[model samples]
Target chain A: MKPLYVIKIGGNVIDNSENLYHFLKDFTALDGYKILVHGGGKIATQISEQLGIEAKLVDGRRITDIETLRVVTMVYAGLINKNIVAQLQRFGTNAIGLTGADGNFIKAVKRPVKTIDYGFVGDLNNSSVNANNISNLMEAGFTPVFCALTHDGDGQMLNTNADTIASALAVALAKHYDTTLIYCFEKKGVLKDINDEDSLIREINPLRYEELKKEHIIHSGMLPKLDNAFTAIACGVKAVVIGKSDELGKLGNNEPFGTRLSKSNIS
Target chain B: MKPLYVIKIGGNVIDNSENLYHFLKDFTALDGYKILVHGGGKIATQISEQLGIEAKLVDGRRITDIETLRVVTMVYAGLINKNIVAQLQRFGTNAIGLTGADGNFIKAVKRPVKTIDYGFVGDLNNSSVNANNISNLMEAGFTPVFCALTHDGDGQMLNTNADTIASALAVALAKHYDTTLIYCFEKKGVLKDINDEDSLIREINPLRYEELKKEHIIHSGMLPKLDNAFTAIACGVKAVVIGKSDELGKLGNNEPFGTRLSKSNIS
Candidate 1:
């Protein structure tokens, strides 16, 4: 199987133009088939506020009301996604910007009405991710840039998490290609000391992950990210790395770059 | 060669929910490869007013400054495009929403500064539209829903005229398929009397078009539209129709549904 790179970049990287361009340059320089999944940054919130829409959140997850959905769709799918695709095109890469709604690429179910309804938010199903369309596009020499939006297959576009999208896409594409999922952000990697830059963990296994959680070292935002990374590894993705966006090539080449997540301690 | 339907709907139809859905049903019922080009409606102007951005216009055409460009991109690509695609999906038609930036499908050069500058507005070039990708996608069974946003191929998304996009795409796709370009607006057809619906002209040829212009019957907005239609017909689109959108199938079958533009009056 040919190698495919499925990289996810968070809002922190996207919000900073310098970081985004630097990361895009590195991303364009990489070899092999690639797909980019991106999140809506603070800009969405800023726009929402400007539009007089109050964002509601619970347990760190946004409640995607109708107005919020429109704002995110505008910012993420419109401004951010197109800008990235255009820039990549300028860099000589034929990039296609997409939401999961495009080509029925990803069909998600609106999160069930539970204790806290996430409104228009969607939870991806097992067969939701359509890898064949993406593989065909890549074979035809186009890189797909995806925004954090999906469809319910029944005429509804839903707000989705980019990390989950990256993992789901990696799992789906793993059937056709040797897929490596990378989560890139401002951080170098999972840090041992939250404030210390030099405390970057070289690699981690299932056991170490649990230990870190038990010791409260990986708290707050990094927890869910790491959790998503390990989930990707377990889903047959060839490799998973959480790292700085600019160092993606080094991470892919197995150099000392990011915190590589492994299913077991064998590696 | 398989027949391909490249349909364009005006902002009037799109702004009305019932009309848009009715039009989509008619669109999806037609049997063949298809692409939909849409115009951003009054909602853009409404949003711009709410956002407090002054819309600059010279002789009725918008001058797309950076802020105006963002607004159009948001309204056209984000809200309107996705809604149309989602609705089509509900009707069991696999639809992919697109801006010209997606897949580098349509490349344009920024309209030059002549007497007045149309900031961020683009002029389509001969080599601008990438029809091969659209053909590949249609062959794969996805109907592309195109927004009026195009790219300069140099990291800038430019506001483009949707009617122009429709004509350009029709001309480009004419090479691979027997393309039928349909321009759907609120009117029944190009009427002999503007206020009389029964005065619909069943057919138009280059000679009659010139006569219409000479008589002052076709003036203002209809002028550019007819000019573009004639250009498309000259460029080898198998047929061109300007009509009510709900009558697409009848138009396809030549059942006197719309004003059919012909290269010569012989037919």
Candidate 2:
């Protein structure tokens, strides 16, 4: 067995704590075999308002100012990151919260998009994941928790989206320990339709995904998730799945659940 | 006049919703800002214990196992981040939660500590911060809340502490918009005697701090906080102040708040 799994979660799963708790229980049961990454854009926006601080975005990417970045670090790293680690510990699993800012486990460059000022948003260009560090944690029987934030060579907290984060992280871990990628969110699977809950897309291919996206059948957010799935596959990840977080272990099996995404060249 | 303030919060002060609620109330009253950075560590350790996870740490660092990481991502970046942001929004603060993994804002390099495997922990090395993201957010009147977890180019979560995070972020923002670094925590101030609260070392210079440290008057954790504060000053940060979270804006006025650190070369 590869003994490693890469999981990415979105804001919806986070809002559902009971589901999250149960998911944690299940996750720990597979101890020393998984790395968890998450996103918190919606939450950060909410907190910014509370502080009477407005949130700024240029070209769809968050503009991380001083006060906003402060709330982000405090909420994501301090409160949220620790909360997940503590809950896992409570369930007899050792977990540590981390960001890309530490130990250079991951390296990113600033995204210089045309016309739009992405600002602190980082583009996935370089990474230097140390397997020794990950192996040591696994050897010590611990899990590493992560949020969607990165530090540039300059002293700034760059913004990254969950799908992009998941894809990048999956590539790192996949190459590190021959792992599979599981991207979890609100929907059990990616739906072909944006409005119809029953139109759950059973499976998808990179080409077919493009067609759906081009046709506007699937909305914008899911397109990024799908794109990430393909990126993971291209970067040598064993496989990629999009679904609800609680069903990872069960779905990641040979007869996996959720929406499976494969490279057109593969299947 | 840039209308920005970087408030760095500690995990100790925001362990619960009630504590955070009050903190948000006061934070909202302050002038409009663009960023907020937060920290949370103790709760993660606490919950890890409740779950029967061993919570392994070698040389003050936790191993990044899969299970632990998952719980951490869910709790910190996902759950806690959103919860706090949502609470702030409820308090009328428009806050958004962010993790380092989301944006490659804070990039790092792996610490090459000989013989010791600090799994997933990155050294504070990167300085390429896109203050434009923050500035844009500020201009848009949005608060960008950030957590410490960042994604490498390859997308792995690096373990980062909040102190350096605050300092680095402060430097980024201050340089971007010429702002202040407000570090808030439970401690009244940096103390010469851990046992004697009144022995608060009102202030200290780098040379004198080194002497006090050699005399064994400083704790290991405090060493890093002070070091980071100094780092910010050197990096062009206007000021750094430590105070309680509830009274974040009151520091530098009359309150006996937390310690303030500056560059030794300044004098």
Candidate 3:
């Protein structure tokens, strides 16, 4: 099977121009089919503040009210997504930016009113990802840059989590391609000591992941990310990586950098 | 050849919820391949006012500074375009929203500074449209909703005019389809008298168009729109119509609803 890289970049990378420039260069240099899933950064919050809209959060998850949804859609899909596509085009990568609604690439269900009413938020799973159309686009030689937004397949647009989207895409494309899902952020990898920059845990298996969690080495913030990584691995994604943005080229080459997640030990 | 309808809706229709809802319903009902091009309505101006971004208009044309370009990209591509696509999908139209930048379907050159420096404005002609990708997308069974924004083949996104985009798409697709370009606006048709809604000019051939202009019957804002219609007709489009938004279905059936621009007199 042909290899396809599905890379997800967080706010730390996208909010900084220098980091984005470096990461995009490495991304364009990586040969073969690739997809980029991007997260909304501080810009959305800043814009909301400017517009006098309040950002609500519950247990580290955003409550996407109508106004917040509008702000994120504009920032994520419009500003950041287009800017990235154009820059990739400049680098000779024929990139097309998309929200899940464009071409119905991804259909998600609006999060139901639970304990907290998360307005216009979407929850997606493997079935929600339109892998056929996306694979067709890759076959046609257009790299897709997806923003963190999805449609209910009826008429509503919903704000979604980028980490979950990356995992969903990776799992969906795993059948057609040997998929590698990489989560690029500010950290080098899952660190043994949070305060120590050089303490990188290179490779992790399902067993090690639990051990680390029980030891309290993997804290609250990295919990969701690690869960997504493990989920992608279990769903048949060949590999998953959580690493620093600057090390993307190394990840592309299958070199040892960042924390690599596997179902078991890759022995 | 299969027929293709290329419709351009101005700000008046988009700014009003009822008008847009009505127009979308009628548009989805139209048979055959179709493309919808929409202009940024007063919403952009409204947001600009709130953001304290000064909108500069010279000779009734917007002077797109960097900030204005950002606003239009957010509103047209992000908010309006996505909303329209999702709504159309609700009506079972299988709609896919696009900016010219999306698939690189349309490439425009930034307007060169002469007497006035129209900061990030784009100028597009026939060759600027990428009809091949569009035809392939239509063949894949998706109706395209285009917003008035384009990119330089390089890295810059430019603000483009929706009317010109509709004409360019019509002219480009004319080679593949029997194209009918419709410009739907607030008025019923090109009226012989501006005040008299009943004074509709039924059919307008090139000869009559010239005569009407020479006799001072056609004046003001309609002149540029007429120019685009004539240009489309000359470039091999089968027909062109300028009429009211609610009359979209009537125009599609060749019912002689609007000021139809044709090569010769259809008597």
Candidate 4:
């Protein structure tokens, strides 16, 4: 199977134009099939505030109300997604911006009203992804750029987590291709010391992950992300990388760009 | 060649929820390949007002300043486009919403500033439409739902006229498909008398069009639309239909739903 990269970029890179530009340049320079999953940046929140829509929270978790969903759909799927696609096009990448609703590529269920209604938030199930259609699109020479939005398959757009979208896509496409899921955030991978970049863990296999967790080195904030990464690996994704967005070019140079997570250290 | 419907819906249909829902259902029910081109609705203006972005007009013509461009990009390409795509998907049409930037599908040149600086407005030239790529996408079984947005190849998204985009697409795709361009608006069709619905001109050939202009039956507001329609007809589009969006279902029944323009009435 051909190697395919499923890269997810968070709001940190998207909020800064210079970082986005440099990251896109590096992304375009990489050869092979790739898919981009982008998170909603601060623009959505800013727009929501401007529109006088208050952020609803349920026990500290953000709630995606109708207004917030609309704003996110506009910012994530519209403004940022198209801008990235246009920039990629400028660099000779035939990029097509997408939401899960497009082509029914990802059909998600509205988060069930348990304890509290999540409003328009969608949670993915095993059958949510149409991997065959995505592979067909990539084979037809169109690189998909997805925003952090999915649909309920009943005429409603739903806000979804971008990291979950990336992992979902990576796991689904793993059957068709040797997939590597990369999560690009503010940090330079998982670190032994959160304050120190040089303390990057480099590589964390299942054994190392358990050891780190038992040692209390892996904190609560990074647990979910690591768990998600390991889950993807178990589901057939060849590897998962966590790193900073600006250092994307290092992947091409075969340099240790970030923390690589796999079943074992021996690849 | 396969028959294809290239339909353009103006703001009137889009602004009303009932009208848009019914129009989408009708659109989905139509047999054969179809593409939807939508105009920016009042929502853009509403959002612009909320964002405090003033409409910059020069000599009665709206100038698309960078601010206005951003708002429209958010509304048209993001909100309206995705909503339409999601709704269409619910109706079982695998609709993919798009701007010209996606897949480098439509490349436009920024409008040249002569008497007016249109800011980020894009003008479609002869080579603007990527017919082959569009045809390939359609053949792949995905319906293209377009918003009035294009890119200037150099990483800029330009505000484009939906009518122009529809006609340009029709003219270009005519080579690959038997294309019929439909413009859906508030009126029933081009009327002999503006006040009377009974005065609907059911058919207009070039000779009849000249007579209508000579008799002053076709008013200033309708001239550009008709000129565009006739130009498209001359450029190999099989026909052009102007009518109310709600009456779309009438077409399936072989009933006169709108004023049909062709080279001659005999067709």
lDDT of 4 at B166: 97
The CA lDDT at B267 in model 3 is 24
Please give the TM-score for the first chain of candidate 3.
0.94
Worst 10 residues of 1 chain B by lDDT: B246-255
Q: Tell me, per candidate, how large a share of the native contacts it keeps.
A: 0.70, 0.02, 0.53, 0.87
lDDT of 2 at B78: 47
The worst-scoring run of ten residues by lDDT in candidate 1 chain A lies at A246-255
Each prediction's TM-score versus the true structure = 0.94, 0.49, 0.94, 0.97
For model 4, how does the per-residue alpha-carbon lDDT over B49-134 read when each residue is reduced to its tens digit? Answer: 98988999999999999888889989998999999999999999999999999988899999999999989999999899999888
In DockQ, how does model 2 score against the reference complex?
0.04
The parts of candidate 1 lying over 4 Å away from their true place are A57-61, A207-221, A249-254, A264-267, B58-61, B211-220, B252-254, B264-267
Pick by DockQ: which candidate is best? Answer: 4
Model 1's DockQ score: 0.71
Tens digits of per-residue lDDT for model 3, B1-267: 999999999888899988999899999989999999999999888877877889898888669999998888888888888888878877878787777877788889999989888999889965798898888778877788999999997878999989889999999999999999989988899999999989999889999998999999998988988987898899899989888998887855757677888898662
Model 4 off-target regions past 4 Å? none
Q: Encode model 2's per-residue lDDT on A1-267: one tens digit a residue.
A: 465778887777776787778777777676447888877736667555645677777757567666666666656665566556656655655455666554334446777767876566766663535455455545444466777766554434555665676667667666567676777777778776656657777677777777777888877667566666776787788778777777766753545567777764332
For model 3 the TM-score comes to: 0.94
Using TM-score, rank the candidates from best to worst.
Answer: 4, 1, 3, 2
Best by lDDT: 4
**Residue-level lDDT for A173 in candidate 4:** 96
Instruction: State the displacement of the C-alpha of residue B258, model 4, in Å, after optimal TM-score superposition.
Output: 0.6
